[model samples]
Target chain A: MPVVELEGVTKAYDGGVVGLQRASVSIGRGEFVFLVGPTGCGKSTCIRLLLKELEPSEGEVRIAGKPLSKIPRKRVPMLRRNVGTVFQDYKLLPNRTVYDNVAYSLEVIGEGRDQIRRKVPDILRLVGLSTKLHAYPDQLSGGEQQRVSIARAFVNHPPLLLADEPTGNLDPETSIGIMQLIYRINRTGTTVVVATHDKEMVDKMRRRVVELREGRIVRDQESGLYRPDESTTEFAIRLRGELGIGAEGHPN
Target chain B: MFFFKEALRGLRRSTAPALAAMLTVLITALVLGVFIPIVQATMGAASDVRDRVVVDIYVAEGASPAERESAQRAIERTANVRSVEFISKDEALARAREKNPRAFREGSELLGSNPLPASFRIVPDDPTKVGQVVDRLAPKGPEGAREPQLTAIDEVRYREEDTQQILSVTGLVTVVTGGLALLLVVASVALIANTIRLSIFARRREVEVMRLVGATNWFIRWPFMIEGVIVGFTGVALAVVLLTAAKESVLEPLSDRWAFLAAPDTIAYPLLVGLLVLAGVAVSAAGSGLTLRRFLKV
Candidate 1:
């Protein structure tokens, strides 16, 4: 079964604004997928829907083969426990140390002290931050902070990992390190979905890419580059426009 | 254990607002402590004065024995009349001389007579109903019947103004203290709520992070609630200490100086302490809980 599936999902905000209209996608287990789109193109909306943060206006969202609409409000946390999430800004608790930051996820779910002690250090070592366990977020570099966030997300070994521009704020070199860490995490049989506008990284990775334009999927292909194919379709024209190429599908 | 630690940490981080909340609770509790006893004491003094109020019926000096007997019988038959004691002319003279010997001597020498009328002191069953008993015994008639007749009674006298003053003072004391207590309570709650709101606002980002990390609403709320309870208990403890000190150093000395104005002893010290602590906890906990509802929408 697909680990993540959105069948005809639609999201409309107030005042008749379309966030995502009839958007659909699916991801098999252990697959690495990149969700590339411009701002307001429903990338964050899609991630939010998967996390059950926002309800889809008109469709089914099934994570791990269980429909989200069927999950009670009290069970959202349970769903979240099984899904790891990372953000570009590194949403680490400023008051906590790196070790505590990773351990917090387990503590919230009432994991035993022995399990937390075993897992937090192991995950931190995986993210290459085992030596910086006592450092606070403010004490770390941007790359180090993002690593803490990654460690926190992956501490539980969730089946699905979602990273929303995990390296958006980093330098190119640091971004590469962060991407490598995520790639390694995805290799451990965990389905990874990254939503980003990182063109260089998308072109370099050549993984499965799902492109969105104005709340609709414009392209879905394995080994896709950052830019669209050499076609004159309407979606290709809009994609070219978004990529800042000329109207005739050629670089300026 | 985690909640407790988090709550203590929260309290430590927001020391300024927590201290302000504690002070508000202290001031509120102090006002209640002082006024509650004062109001009780005032009422007690008023009732004491009321119990001592009696009506005095002065008879003419030349009244016969039969007339005195009739007057006594009339007083006994009056509703709410508890008891009646008759003082003869000689007994009245002797009592007057004992009370003010100089005035008695001067008056007897100047007038060459006892110059005192026999009287009956009538006590009522209920001190509050002295007016009714007095009215029953001394009935008013039309103006045509106002002439001085050959009746045994010369005049009727009681402390009308004193009783009225006590009643009015106690009534005013009750109303003013009750209002002030209510106002203080409301002010305390508002102050506490505002303080909690500021603290929560400062940590709104932290709350968002917790929500994103799948922390339940109760998990996010327990820390604030515990912080509020801590603030409340601390405030009550401080207020109780101040009240105890004030009672020992100020109230005891004042009560000693003014022997007639009794101190409040109806409520025991332990019970008062327990009540103050309970009120402090309740107000602070309720204030935090109520204010937190707005921020827990996540």
Candidate 2:
């Protein structure tokens, strides 16, 4: 069974901005799914929906076969316990050491110290950040910080992992390294969904790619590259001609 | 134990704000500690004064010796009267000399001519009874006795000004101390709420991450709420220490030197300590709960 299911999900922000438009997608356990889209095409929103960060206005989102809405408020933490989240910004608490950052997810779920003690070191080593355990977030490089963020996300060994532009701030080499790390985590039966726009990296990987255009899914294919059907000049022509009557700098 | 260690790290991370909050609470508690015991002692001493004041009534001229005895018996029987003593003219002079040796010289021009009155000194076990005794014992004389007095008593003497002044001062101390304590309590609540609010703000991103992971509302809120309580507890402990030191080193010494005000250490110390600690825990818990409610929704 799929670990996450989204059916015709739509999200509209206040003041009439649409974040997602009737989007539907499914991701199975151990599957590595890449979301590729232009800026503001709901790629991040899609990941957020799967993570239950935002509720869809028009459709249902289900995690592990249970409707997100049907999950009781008190059980939200339990639901999170089985899922791991990473962000491009590397949201490690500044005051905490790298070890504490990875251990925090366990602490937040009230996992006993013994479990945290046994699990955190191993997870840090898996992320290749064990040597930096005592280092604070500010002391680490951008790559190291992102690694810490990844380690924190994977520390609890959640069955599902959502990374929102996890490599957005890293160099291309570092980006590939992080993607490889994501692939390793996926091999462990954790479904991985990454939202990014790195064309070269996405093309070389040749994984399942779901591309978004203007808040809608334009293409979804297995072992796909980044926007294989849409040419850049065609988009430029559309930007200048078919969408010419709209405001300048607006893309369709 | 681990949370405590974490809390210590958190405090070290944000030392400036934590120290400021701690000092604010400490000063508030110190003022409370100093005033609470002093107020108690003042109140106690006032009541003691009310009970101990004695009223003396002098006998009329030429009242036979038997009438003096009757006056003494009458005063002793009065409501709230603890005891009554008769003082002869010679004894009155003797008491006067004892009170002030200079007033009664060794060799006066006339030695036996100290024409002081024979007075009945009356003391009531309860201060409230002084007025009652005065009221019940009126003039018991012939038909033509003077309007205000005097077959049995010629004059009455009581330290009305001194008693009134002491009670007024004690009442004022109680009102000021109580009012200030109430003010500090309100301020402590405000400060604690503000501290928790800032602490919540710092952890806002962590809360967002937890929500993303599908953490239950309780799971996300428990740690921050606990942090608020910890801040409150630490602030109170600091304040208590400051208070104890101030009372021992300053307020106690001042009270001891001032005869009118009993020393606070012996009298008000326990009550002060109890009130400060209680205020600390109550304000901290309430403040934490109130502030954390806003963040729990995330």
Candidate 3:
């Protein structure tokens, strides 16, 4: 069974502003999927919907076979506990050390001190942030901060991890490191869904790419490039012409 | 334990606002502590004065000895009368001389006979029922009549106007103190809540991060509640210390200077302190709880 499924989900805000319409996507356990779209193309909206932060106006959202609408208000935290999230800005608590930031995830769940002591360092090592455990968020570089964010998100070992523009602020070299980290995390049987706008990274990874345009899913394919095929749309044709390159499938 | 640790850390981070809230609690408790005793003491003094009031019935000078004796007997037999002491003419003269010795010595040569009249001092079973006893003993006369309808009784006095004034003043004192106390309580709660809100506002981003990380609503709120309790307990303890100091330095001297208006001893000191501490903690916790209700939407 798919670990995450959205069947014809539609989200409409006040004044009939469409956030996402008829957006259906599914991912099985341990699969890495990329959610790529332009700004305001419902990328963040999908993440918000999956987190149950915003309810869909129509259709069903099922995470791990449990319908989101059926989950009580009091149980939203339980749902979130199972789904780890990473953000673009690396929302680390400024007052806390890297170790504390990662341990906070387990602390909120009332994990024992021994469990936290054992888990926090292990996750910090996984994120390659073991040396920076005692450093504060401001004391770290942008890439280091993102690593701390990853450590925090993965500390609980949630089965499903959603990253929203995780490397949006980093340079290309640093972005590669973050992508590799996420890729390594997904290899451990955790289904990873990443919403990003980095076309080069998406093309290089060549994972299942789901493209959204104007709040609608325009493309979903295995080993898909960031842009559509040249013949499909004027935007893609002009983009290919500008780059002076023939239509060619990205290498696996 | 995590919540408590977080609360202690939060307190250290937001020391200024936390201290402000504690100061507000201290001031609130201090006002209550000082005013409560004053109110009790004032009421006690009023009641003491009320209890001292008695009805004095003077016997007419020209009345026969049998008539005077019969008047005394009549006063003693009144339903509300607790006791009656008959003062003879000689005893009345002696009392008058003792009250104004120089005047009596000079007046005794000028006047041949004693001017003071024999009287009955009537103590009522209930101080509030003194008027009833007086009515039963004094004979009713026509309106504006200067003389008593009964020939043996010359006059009846119970200081009705003074008693009325005392009662009205006591009522006014009670009402004014009650209103002031209520206003102070509301102001204290608001001040403390606002202080807590300022600290919460400072840490709102942290709260949002906690919520997004799947912390329960109570998990987020427990730290704030613990902070409030600490502030409350500390403020009340300080206020109690100040109150004790004031009692020794201020109230004790005042009670000595004004011996007639004695301080109330009805409430034990320990009990008063315990109640103040309880009130302080309750108000502080309630203030924080109320403020958190609006901010802890997660």
Candidate 4:
């Protein structure tokens, strides 16, 4: 089954602003997808819709073929339990130790103490933070904190992972490491959807790329580049034409 | 088990807001504790003054003994008349002599027969109702002329102006104090809720992470609610202790030094303490639970 699908979905915000417009997209189970767009182009809105954070003003969003709109508000947590997410801000529990942070996911889901004891360390090890198990989020570097957040998100081994700019705050070197980690998780048959504006990263991955512009899904390409090869050319030609340049490219 | 542990851990994690919340509760509880008894005691004194507002009804000199007895019985039956004491002419003379011994002794040689009028002293059930009692005994005529409502032999006397003044002043005190008490209770509730909101704002990140991980709203709310109760309980408990100490150390000594300062009856110390503790816990827990709704919408 397709793990995530947005069919003719439109999200209009307050004040008559449209965040997304009639966007239809689908990702099969275990497929990796990238949502790339300029800021304010509804990239975050698309991610938010899939997470059931925003109800579509039109159309439907389905995860694992179940319409998100049908899930009762009280059951949103259960829906979230099956999906993992990482954010640009690395929303770690600041007061908790690295071990507790990762283990908290399991605890919330009511895993047995013995299972928590067994699973928490293994996940921390996977995030390469075994030595810093007792360190608080504030004590970690930016990259280290992101790893802790990742470990926490993936510790439940949720079937679907949605990351909205997971590496936005990291250095390029650190960003590469985080994305590679995410890539590895995606390899394990967990469908991953990453929403980011990182050009180098998106271009390097060459994954299924969906781009938004002015709330419209202007581009969707398999093995796509961050920019559609000719998107900026029309803009350049239009600007030149306004400034009295000839069709042959000289100013007349 | 998980709920409590999480709550305790939350408290340990965010000591500043928790302590702030506790201190807010403590200060408010302490102020209320001090203010409540004072209001009650003042009210008691006012009531005492009200009880002292009395009406005196006199009988004629030629009235028969049976007539005097019937007059006394009628005064007792009058609405708002709590009790009536029959003061015979002789007894009135005796009381006058005791009150002004020098005058009585000086005038003894000139005195021929007892000149004091036999009267019944009427104590009203409520001081504010003193006018009603007087009017009941002396109903007015169609032209607003004064006439005896009952078969009173001679005269009726009371400090009408003084009673009116006392009632007005006491009524004002009640309104002001009751208003102040209501305001403080609302302030106490608001103070705790604001403190909880600030603390929650501080932990928004933690709450965000919890939501990301799929923790239910109740799961997150339980810890905060418990923490709020803990903070409130301790704060008010401490306030109660301070109140008891203050009452024992300061109020008791003052009351002893001046008997009039002591109320005949006020809210029992035990009951006041129990109510304060209940209020603190409720406000604290409610503050946390209700304020949390905004954050959980994410």
Candidate 5:
């Protein structure tokens, strides 16, 4: 069964603003998918939908083959525990050490002391932060802090992982490291979905890319380019370049 | 158990707003501690004053027993009369002697016959209604010729001016003091609640992230609520300590000067303390729950 599926889902907000318009996509287990678009193109909306943080206006959202509409509000937390998530801000408790930050996820789910002790250390080591266990969030670099966030997200070995602009605040080199860490996690049989603006990384990875434009899915391609087949505006620009038209001023 | 440990850990790593919430609760509890006694004393004093709004109707000393009996009945029939007691001339003399034995000792012995007039003491059910009893029983005919109207009665007096003055003054005192006390109590309690809200608001981002990581609402709520309870308890404890230290040094000396403060109806200090503790714990728990709800909407 597909691990994530959206069948004709729509999400609309107040003032007639539609966040996602009849967008449908499905992801099989262990698939790595990137949602790429410009700002306000509904990338975050898609991520929020999968997390059940939003209610689709028009259709069905199925996670792990169970319809989201059927899940009671009381059961949402359990659903979240099984879906690890990362964000751009590296939402770590400011006062907690890196080790405790990762351990918290386990503790939240009522993991036993032995299990928490075993898993926190193992995950911190996996994220290459075992040496920085005692370091507070403020004491770490942005890259290291994002690593701690990722470690916290992945400690439970959740079946599905979602990252929204995971490297939006990081330098290009650090962004690559974060993406690599995410790629490695996907390899462990966890279905991964990323909503991002890093066009260069998306093009370099050549993964399945689902591109959004004004709340609608404009393209869904396997091994897709970030700027898939020239859009009308891009096509116009290319034609202009070839014809030796004015580049800086409109040809009158 | 795990949540409690988490709560303690949070308190140890306390922020400025958390400390502020604690201070607000302490100040609120302190206000209540001192104000509760004053309120109790004022209410007691007001009631004590109200009980004195009695009207006395005096009958002529030369009147026959039948005339005095009819005079007593007229006082009883007056409007707003709760009860009327007849005071025979001899009994009136005896009460006067009892009240001031030294002053009456020689005076009463010298009088051949009891010079005191028989009287009817009137008590109204409502103190403010004392004027109604006075107006109905007092002689009301043309000034000099008023006696034919209430022939057996010589005078009907309620200290009407004094009764009216007491009613208005006490009413004003209660309305003003009660209104001020009410305002202070609401402001103080709301301050405590808002301080708790601000403390939770300071950690809203932390709450947001926890929700992102799939923490249940209860999981997010439990630690903060526990933290609030601790803050509230400590704040109330400090206030109680301050109040206790001042109870004898402050309240006792003041009560000696203010008779109403030592009245039997005053609220027991221990009971007031218990109520303060309960208020602190209750306000803290409720404030935390209500404020955290806004953040838990996601």
Candidate 6:
């Protein structure tokens, strides 16, 4: 079974506004997937649904083949132990050091001090932030902060990592560097789902891309590039590739 | 434990507020510790003076010893008198000599006779009943002599000066110290509550992150609550120190200044500490709980 599966999912917010409309997708373990859509196309909402921050108004969501509702409330934290989320805004707590921010996930799960001291350094090293462990979030550059956020997400060694526009605020070089770190982490058997409008980054990575338009899945394919329907789509198609058209009837 | 470290780090960020809170708790506990015992001691001395009051009932002239004994029995049987001791005319003069040696030595030369009257000293159980017993002893009939034959009681005297001083000081100190303690309590509550609130506000993002991480309401709330308790306990410790200092320097001297005021005894020390700590923890918990209600709920 897929690591994350959403079937006939619909989300209608308060005041009768619909966030998503009957969306369906299955993300397998160890797969790197890109969720591409225009702004307000329910990308963040979809991420929130997977994070169990919000329950869908209709249909069911299953994580690792267990329905989200079937998991008891007491076990929700444990369920989150298997999934890590990163925000484009780099939700690093401003009051905490980089090491503290990374160690927070483990601390929430009641890991001992020795375990945190041992594991936080390893995770920070993994994210190329070993030297910046003592730095506060405000002191770091945007890319460094994003790296800290990534470190916090991956510290628990969760099998699934959700990135919601992970590079939304970085320069191209820094964004690429972050993408490389994410790719490296993904290679270590963590299922990575990145939500972004960065067509160039998505195409350069060349992962399975799921394209959404107006809250519905427009396309899902492996090694796929961004489509040209929504914002920056034309740029995505140009940055990546397109479906080859044959000149002859049978073979090109 | 990490949360506590986080809390301590947060507290270190602003030393002044922490100190201000600690000082508030200290001053409050000191005032409480001192004010309570003073009021209690004052009340104790007042009641003691009131209980020691006795009414002296003089016997009629030429009354037989047996009649005087019966009169003493009657005085004892009265509802207000706790006990009655009869003093013969000679005995009265002798007691007077003991009280005033010069009065005994020159009494015959000045008066030309032994004119002192025999009296029954009446000790009333209730201090308030002394006046009633004196009134009852006065002559009831217009035709009768001003002094009755079997008078219920006579002159009523009490240690009024000492009791009055005790009562007045107790009342004044009670008002002043009660007001001060109330003010300090309010200040402590506000200081502790604001400190915890600021800490929670600083960590609001982390709290939200924990919520997103699927931490239960209790798990998210526990750390802040624990941090509040730590703050309260620390404040209480500082308060106990201040109270100890006040007990030695202020309360002891005050007790000496008024010997009737009981010493700051060691027995009340544990009770003072217990009350201060309990109040600190209760206030901290209540304050943190009220402030975190909004954040803890899903």
Model 2, A1-252: lDDT tens digits are: 788888898999789989889888888878888899989999888876765557788899998888897876566667777878888898778888999887878887778989999999998888788788999999999888988888888888899898889889988657767877787899988998888997766766779999898788888899887777658875565445423332221110
* lDDT of candidate 1 over B102-178, digit per residue (tens): 99889988999777888999888886788787766665557523222338888777888987776677667667766
Better of 4 and 5 by DockQ: 4
TM-score per candidate: 0.76, 0.70, 0.77, 0.86, 0.83, 0.69
Off by over 4 Å in 4: A227-252, B59-78, B81-98, B101-119, B142-145
* Model 4 per-residue lDDT tens digits across residues B26-49: 999999998888788777877777
Task: Name the lDDT value of residue A180 in candidate 1.
Answer: 83
On TM-score, the candidate that comes out on top is 4
The two-chain DockQ for each candidate, comma-separated, is: 0.41, 0.35, 0.49, 0.58, 0.49, 0.28
A55-155: candidate 1 lDDT, tens digit per residue: 99999999989999999988888888888999988888887889988888988888999999999999888888888999989999999999998888888
Ranking by TM-score: 4, 5, 3, 1, 2, 6
Local lDDT at B3 for model 4: 88
lDDT of each: 0.82, 0.73, 0.82, 0.86, 0.85, 0.74
Measured against the true chain A, the candidates' chain A TM-scores are: 0.90, 0.88, 0.90, 0.90, 0.90, 0.89
Shift in Å, residue B207, candidate 2: 4.0
- lDDT-based ranking, best first? 4, 5, 3, 1, 6, 2
Better of 4 and 6 by DockQ: 4
Flag regions of model 3 displaced more than 4 Å. A230-252, B39-163, B250-254, B259-262, B265-269
Error of 2 at B277 (Å): 2.3
Candidate 6, A181: how far from true, in Å?
Answer: 2.4
List runs of model 2 lying over 4 Å from the truth.
A107-118, A230-252, B38-180, B210-238, B256-260, B263-267
- Name the regions of candidate 6 deviating beyond 4 angstroms: A15-17, A110-119, A211-223, A228-252, B1-10, B13-24, B27-187, B210-226, B259-270, B285-293
Off by over 4 Å in 1: A230-252, B12-16, B30-36, B39-169, B259-262, B265-267
How would you encode candidate 6's per-residue C-alpha lDDT over B63-88 as one tens digit per residue? 77777677777667777777777787
Check candidate 4 and list the clashing pairs: none
Least well predicted 10-residue stretch by lDDT in candidate 4 chain A: A243-252
Which one wins by lDDT: 3 or 5? 5
Provide the lDDT at A76 for model 6: 71
